[model samples]
Target: MHRVRPLPNYLVQRYHGWKATGYADNKAWYRRLASDGQHPRAMVIACCDSRVNVISIFGADQGEFFIHRNIANLVPPFQPDGDHHGTSAAVEYAVQVLKVSNLMVLGHSGCGGIQGCIDMCKGHAPELEDKGSFVGRWMDILRPRFESVRDIADDKEQAREMEKQAVVTSLQNLMTFPWIEEKVNAGELTLHGLWNDIGEGSLENYSPESGAFHPV
Candidate 1:
């Protein structure tokens, strides 16, 4: 039998504290959300890094944004093969069902997944190159973008550029989906790419015209 442990005490205590305070203070809003369902205007694809808080950064309340978190904040190409594609599924739901008007891909500095991709591409992370490594396979989505930044002599600069490239790669892949492309062409949906400097608490918006990320 597979063993499943109970919730840790600290987490339980935290949940109780939030239930008593945050939940109690917003009981009516919670109830309304439960009854009315979510009608968020935007969908955000962000990294699974603990430091990257999509809600706090945007000052968004619960249900205000349909957010999807994944390693490196990646969106793979539109592959309709019979396979489990969590990120793609989320995008389909957000676009087809929820009909969100905006879709944003948010990347962050010092992302472990991005670093892992760097190490893997440089042949430094052998474990990640293993056939059984899920992370390695997932990071492949960003592998093609690594070549664009590889010529940078400074390691830190290369990593930073690669992180921003993650956002760009995802944005490009988002358009590969026929529905997303159709909506974008028809002006029903708009796509955005953003990179956040975690330690500095700064955000940059990607501009297609300038082909670069600028401070937001």
Candidate 2:
């Protein structure tokens, strides 16, 4: 790891502003917002990639969306595990407590995690011999997604297709939550699959009709 770092002047100024957010005149506004309680209308499931900041991209202010992020932006099917599940827990709170009306699975191009999943599925990378290796097992969560789209295309097209399929698969898996499913069926909630092309600053929405992502 790099032992030293340079602080961007822009970030330094932002830090100063954030630090002052709780002082004097700002404190009342903060307290008022907190007292009103968070009632975000949407929940976003996004990747842990630094390039994809959902809040900034959507131009959101505080308490706009309850977000859950993980490697490759995955959403594992609901299951009880002894350990803490940060993403799942956030989802539970977003649905049960926040009562968000919409859920979005957001994916982006040039994702390292998706690339790794592609590699592993093509036999170009090593699989975990056991479930103990954290990262190895983590990517394995997308194994079914990988296999589902394996024969759809070749070369770069294949990779892109895989990434999109992964997003759709995660959105489908999101229904594994009974509360989410119930809400969706009753018209209380909606799920969307979104893909962002970082280089082009363009977005696409998944279309079941065309079985493709359309520019949005």
Candidate 3:
């Protein structure tokens, strides 16, 4: 509490601007949204990268998407050990309570988290190996997938592939949840894995049938 301070001047100004323009323009809609609970149809698991704008990419408005962001958009396997599982809890709420029909894992190119995982797997990031390092332990979820791309000679290419692997791994992990599995099997929920190329402004979708990603 001692370290807490008022919002910065620039942020305060920006908030005023948005409140004046965007909020004013949609005042009625915003009021209605506040009164009625959200009913988003999709839940997007995305990276914490600032450049990857999930809402802008899909042209989504407020209340349309339930987004959960993490280091590499990784979803750990289901383990009900009574631990603080933020991602798992989000998934559970989205599936069992929110009942979102579509669950999407969105990965991006040039992700620092993916690079950290690669570095960690190659033993180049010793700091991440420390027991108390949260990023190190979190990146462990993607550590096993690094072996698949380790043979690639091109560093840039390897990183790109690893980024997509993060999405794939998360999709696989989502299935580990029995509720998610049941919904998918009953044709009540659909899972999607997508990769966004920030520089090119292009998107790719992972096809389970083709076992590869294709341009969207």
Candidate 4:
């Protein structure tokens, strides 16, 4: 806990700007949000890419969407062991407590984590293959998807396709949680997969019936 420290000068200045402009202008709304506990209708699980702005792209306002950012937006299979589980805890709390009706897994092009997974699986990134590597271990969730795209002949295409697969895989993994599955089975919850092309600035939604992603 003691490892925490104050922000650097650049980030501090940026925070000051946001606090002065955005936060100050919306003080009343922020205060109301603080008074009334958040009741977001949807939960968006997206990548940690700085360019992929889920809230901005959807034009969602504060307190409207519950967002969780993780590497490649991948969800690991439900593990009940007594250990740290940030992603799983967030999903559980959102579904079981917040009662978010919709859960969207958002993936994006040029995902470094997805690329690392591909490289690691193909023996190109030996550094990530180490047993103690957190990123490597977490990315193992998408390792299976690599094999499906391994023969695509183009590295760029393979990475893009695998990025989409991360969303698909996470949706699959989300159901592994008993609470999530129960809510979904009761028709109280819905699952969605989304992908964004950073360069093109286009969004796509996964079609369950067609098993493909279509532009939104």
- Alpha-carbon lDDT of model 4: 0.92
Q: Candidate 4 on 1-216: residue-level lDDT in tens?
A: 899998899999999999999999999999999999899999999988898898889999999999999999988899999999999999988888899999999999999999899989889998898999999999988898877898999889988899989999999999899988998999999999999988889999999999999999
Give the least accurate 10-residue stretch of model 1, judged by summed lDDT: 1-10
RMSD of 1: 1.0
Q: Which tens-of-lDDT digit does each residue in 1-216 have in candidate 3?
A: 899999999999999999999999999999999999899989999999999999999999999999999999999999999989999999999999999999999999999999998999898999999989999999999999988999999999999999999999999999999999999999999999999999999999999999899999
Candidate 3 or 2, higher lDDT: 3
The 10-residue segment of model 2 with minimum total lDDT is: 127-136
Q: Candidate 1, overall lDDT? A: 0.96
lDDT against the true structure, each candidate: 0.96, 0.83, 0.96, 0.92
Question: For residues 67-118, what per-residue lDDT tens digits would candidate 1 score against the true structure?
Answer: 9999999999999998999999999999999999999999999889999999
- Answer with 1 or 2, whichever has the higher TM-score: 1
Q: How far is candidate 2 from the true structure (C-alpha RMSD, Å)?
A: 3.9
TM-score of each: 0.98, 0.84, 0.99, 0.94
Model 2, position 66, has a per-residue lDDT of 83
RMSD of each: 1.0, 3.9, 0.6, 1.6
lDDT, candidate 3, residue 185? 99
